[model samples]
Target: MSPPKETNNKINTAKSSDGTIVKAGPIVKREKVILHIDGDAFFVGVEIAKNPKLRGLPVVTGEERGIVSALSYEAKALGITRGMPIFRVKREFPKVKILPGDYHSYVEYSTKMFDIVRRYVDDVEEYSIDECFGELTGLDKPLGMSYRQIAERIKKEVNEELDLSVSIGLAPTKVLAKVASNWVKPNGLTVIESALAVDFLQKVPIKKIWGIGPRTAELLNRKDIMTAKDFYDKDIAWIKLILSKPYETIWQELHGISVMEIDSAPKTVYSSVQKTRSFHPSTNDKTFLWSQLSKHIEDSCRKARHFNLVPRKFSIFLKTKDFEFVTALILLPSPSNSPEILLPLAHAHFENIHKKGVLYRTTGVTLLDLMADFVPQDDLFGSNAQASKFETIHKQIDLLEEKFGKIVIYLGSTKNAIDHKAQDGGTDSEDLDKNLLFL
Candidate 1:
């Protein structure tokens, strides 16, 4: 059978050690276990860990209009929430002190944590600069106690080596492990024993299952399915009928396999991004369409900061209901990460796209011709001023975003035209405004 496509977002179910099909609970990375190590309060955690003085204070990271992008568990309990506008966040819990996140620090600690995981597990996938998913293959040597032993070993090393805590979830499949990892926060390792998966999966809300976020879960709930078991009992067509392409992957992974191809080679890290979500389907108002494009480009730039390379070219992809496809790319004089520059180009691309006079079902903005922060010597201009300018401002804005949270800061004047801004007024500088910000 072609690898069974994931049909749901719930991954808590798996075949047990005794050959019984059930839900996962207190999962430990067995021979087949996938240990997903997810950072809790990542940016906030790192800052607190770096400086002892930051501990236990309701620390919000970001700048003006910067909401809580990542809240420490301590902060979360105080009723502070992610995406709550910083202004509102303060109003809700006025006593909390906010600190901007440190990107370089996050990357540094993330590297150290993964280093420990590599010593024990042969397979490691650095899913992001902050999180990792690792496979502990060939654990048969430790006999009956290997999974629990390694899980504990990983936890101990992280505590001793980095002084940082991570939540670990273990299961037979990547999806379950990812969900399990999140079950415990800050410092926790939860294992979903194969036989107990059914009970565990049923108790957790569908949204808690990872792939199904609030929006998808609401849709699932409308269909009267609220738990992993509901999705499990759901037929293939039921899944297809109710879920989108993304949720399909969740369902298959719940069964201990995934449609995703896993290999040692890490997937290409996107240096640029373009995302467009269809509005109420009217697609008629050009102004609304333009806003979406602007939002798309600005969102990509936020993530561009994480990739470490600036982009010099912007590419546009437009799709029409007629299934017509059009793509165009523009190369700038220098690499850039500012929406102000890219949005104008995106508008120009859309203007070209509009010439066909067909309603668009999709639109995308891509940054291409990516290069190092400093461009190499050019024949036309021996000492390029533009490249130097792009680098300085890029770093500055990145610093501001890292500190302020999301799109709270913008290039020159684009700060006024912001979407995805949290109640604190911080906007998503990254793609999750469109993709995971894809993970």
Candidate 2:
């Protein structure tokens, strides 16, 4: 006989090292363990990590032009929300500490955080810049510690070494682990074993379950399935009738079945890639604006090359100081990731869309309609040959930059863009010619 289709079913199982193969009555459904660790107030924490004095103070980062990107817990407590304009924040909370974002340092700390996680478990997934997933299965024996103990140790090490708090969750599946990790905030750890899964899930609202977005949650709510427990209580056949593969996978995951495995590989493909930068005090200079757009285009091209992708189309945009926005789109002559070819085309469209005397604060470039890098087709203008030559030169430039620094070599048009005036009244440049780091 099979387990009950309409209720919380329990089956008697013959326990094995692998945790499957049930015997015949009530048993705990066990599955592989996953641990998810997420940084607390990541950008703000990075700033605090650099200056310990910023700790316990209300901190916010962003708005070289005018919007808040991130806020510390203290600032959040004071009702300072992200995306809120800094001028409003100044008026409401004058004591709030505002700083410009340091993406370079943030990347450094992100690498350190992942490296620390890798020390504990080799199968670590850098889920995001400030989050990671570590497979905890089979790590118990080699480490000589229980899964929860290992998680706690990882948490402690991160705090002691990075001086940043992390919220960690350990559970049978990635979805559940994410839920557990988010259940508590800012230095909390929650472990959900198979036996405790249902009880814990029962308390969570249907909308709170990972992977179930608002539309799906609303659909489930209409059916009176309002809690994780309500979704879990449905039989397999009933779930199959209502949802497709991904939601079905989430259902199985909730039932202690590891349908999704940990993926350690970095993402290789992107539908679109975008790069944007905000300028301080805004500018109406056409040359400076084009230079900023060129910088963004080059940055986007570099990212595409990293993923071995080429875009068939490109979109460029300018955001004016008065919040007016203008955009232009172009179909590439052929799929390409070379800024040398793309930037000139971008300039052609920028001239058409850019209105004179508009104080623009931000410029952005987006590469779209991407596909795997492929050989370009011959065109009427026969730019293929010139494109190939530019491609070869860019490869050499890429190598030099990789060895020396990202800004070692640059196109003349983007030279002014390279030495960007910092929002905080400083000049931020990555010119290794000025200073080099031995490490």
Candidate 3:
């Protein structure tokens, strides 16, 4: 049986004990100006930055994963897309150039881009490797430039110093800023004032709203809410009742009300840390499979330590050639981030899930239930001393790696995975350090 649609009967007015009608306080509106800066094909842009000759040519990255991770606008003009198999691209688009991903260079460029933004605006949110949101409210008079002029200056500086193209959007809120940034492609600048937001939102489909997924878009379509303006036109109480809090926040932003604040703080705590690697040519050799899993554990633990965190539980998984996952979760006796402590437990569980002659293509480990490693807590069995000793050793190892590069001193178990050459003649795996630590 179909259930009845939930209804909201709440109103803005209320009755006091004295039977007097009372109305809610007047709505307070705040003025906010946000800018979203997005890179145009960031990974490919970095490659072109290194060698200007690659510009105006069809180029792609992700040679390591045998898939198209990022492609230039020129390549996109030929109908190539992200996640398309490299083999297919070579066969169909013979002239398209494919390059291995230089994640280190990408991270360097990303840092420089955000740093440049911070020089203009102190409140900057590093949204991703290629995207960021900056607050520019009330800075017009002090900075001696309008919001649009500030955005243009930022874009110009980034282009001149980094030799990369960026699209920028200036709007009243982050959601609106994102929409404006994406309005034009490659290198574009768009501004959406609060007064004219409806005009801009009228042309935006519900699916185009940030954080709205396909399923939500389908549901909204069934309700005859087709565009951003349609969604914004709904009653606030009705939206709160029908959708989740996040969507309600988006609805508020669509109306040019600054409901979401810009988070400019650095991320230090995490609930979980995960590291995974997918290699070419599925292998059935038990030793090699264990080596891959070991590397994942080492990488995850390294990140946990960098954040001064330790995990009390973890899970290991292996992906078969047919794309099936076999996983095992293990709870530790105590929270720890030492590879010496995790390797033994992971290997024992790996044996239980490792099927004979079953080829596997990926291996991963996830550290869960993390907490600050301020003080070592000893279990009833009293293993704190041993754990402390390993902690000290890892601190030194981390120092060496920081000075040199990652994996300066890895566990012997990861030797096989580290030494093995890439069968596809690409990178062995993505550098976890560069991919994870962006601060």
Candidate 4:
């Protein structure tokens, strides 16, 4: 990428009430253009997309987990916040609608949304399920449209195709693009030209800046730096003296210099794979808890197998009704991603951690110290042969799952978790039927 271009023109100048000239800063000419696209109330939006009648209603997801995961703008207006207990919402806002989360549908919509942007820009970063950053520099001529026009086209395509609203920001840097995208909400399109960036920054609180958190905002506020413009006006040397490298990068971005590059590569490696599920109504049933943990093992192993990775060690934990965690870490005899090997070990260790009469609300498993799965050399004990056989069986099972649906064929231990309706986002028979329609 070329270095960000700057000009000496002093733009955003204004006359104060006393007729004095107020200069915000020099105009930093646009050298790079980046677009940030974010969905409007993503989870709730997906639910509304699947069923249009749910729109214009106070809706929230996470009914299965007994807490709010995402809420519609209508729900937010009614003082319903994310992570708030569902029982309270029902008691306080009885008119509000609570629905179970359907992550399968969310992932499908996310893929389609980002794919729409990828049609326009090759360098698109899938920042999250509902957000992405695309590099739009130098595409105006080939596309026969301005950067803003290209952004508009992408946004229009996503909205029309997915029946979803996305807010887009066009700016010279990622941070500014993020700010511009959030400037207006739901279905908004805002452009922060390099010359006008300072004008926008003047109104944005320091805490609202992309990477700055509440603690950092408090620290900056101690020094009376309350707005993005305030921080941007400070001396570069002073910023370096007080803040860390990340903040310095933000400052450079605030100066219309693109310090962060768009990362578009797909993730293939992981340090660990963790799967957790919280269910409603804590249970002391050992079979249910084991089934939940077994399901987690299968899910985590499936992910590891997708990346051709094996874990050298793994851990399991159970969350009690009081929110206390009882965890145990186990080292494997060999690195493997097959749940056949993990389930038995987890069952044996379950006894050590399971306290009788303890009501648990969550079960989790983490596969750790992962490395590439390589063919093992033959051993005298024939354990390698057994593992290879299980691997082949799992490969066939994966094919079956791809053809049918996830968990169509799972271990007997996981049957209770799948058959039971009280966990994994509280997906019951009715929710399953609705989800099948989306597929």
lDDT of 2 by residue, 1-439 (tens): 6553353455443322223232323222235779999999999999999999999999999857478998999999999888999899999999999998899988899889888888889888888899999998768869998776787788888888999888888888898888778867878777776666787788899899888999999999999999999999999888899988788999988887878888888778799999998867788889888888987888899889878899999999999898777999899988889888898899899999888878898899999999998766655368897787777777777787788665465566776665554334554664422532211
Full ranking by TM-score: 3, 4, 2, 1
Candidates in descending lDDT order: 4, 3, 2, 1
Q: lDDT of model 1 at residue 232? A: 68
RMSD (Cα, Å) for all candidates, in order, is 11.5, 7.4, 11.2, 6.2
lDDT of the candidates, in the order given = 0.67, 0.81, 0.85, 0.86
TM-score of each: 0.61, 0.75, 0.85, 0.82
- Which pairs clash in model 3? none
State residue 137's C-alpha deviation in candidate 4, in Å.
1.0
Q: What are the per-residue Cα lDDT tens digits for candidate 3 across 79-155? A: 99999999999999999999999999999999999999988999998889999999998777689986667887899
Please write out the lDDT profile of model 4 over residues 53-108, one tens digit for every residue. 99899999998777999999999999989899999999999999899999999999
The TM-score between candidate 2 and the true structure equals 0.75
C-alpha positional error of residue 362 in candidate 3 after TM-score superposition, expressed in Å? 2.4
In model 1, how large is the Cα lDDT of residue 213? Answer: 81
Query: Of the pair 1 and 2, which is ahead by lDDT?
Result: 2
Judged by whole-model lDDT over C-alpha atoms, candidate 2 comes out at 0.81
lDDT of 3: 0.85
lDDT of 2 at 317: 96
Q: Pick the candidate with the highest TM-score.
A: 3
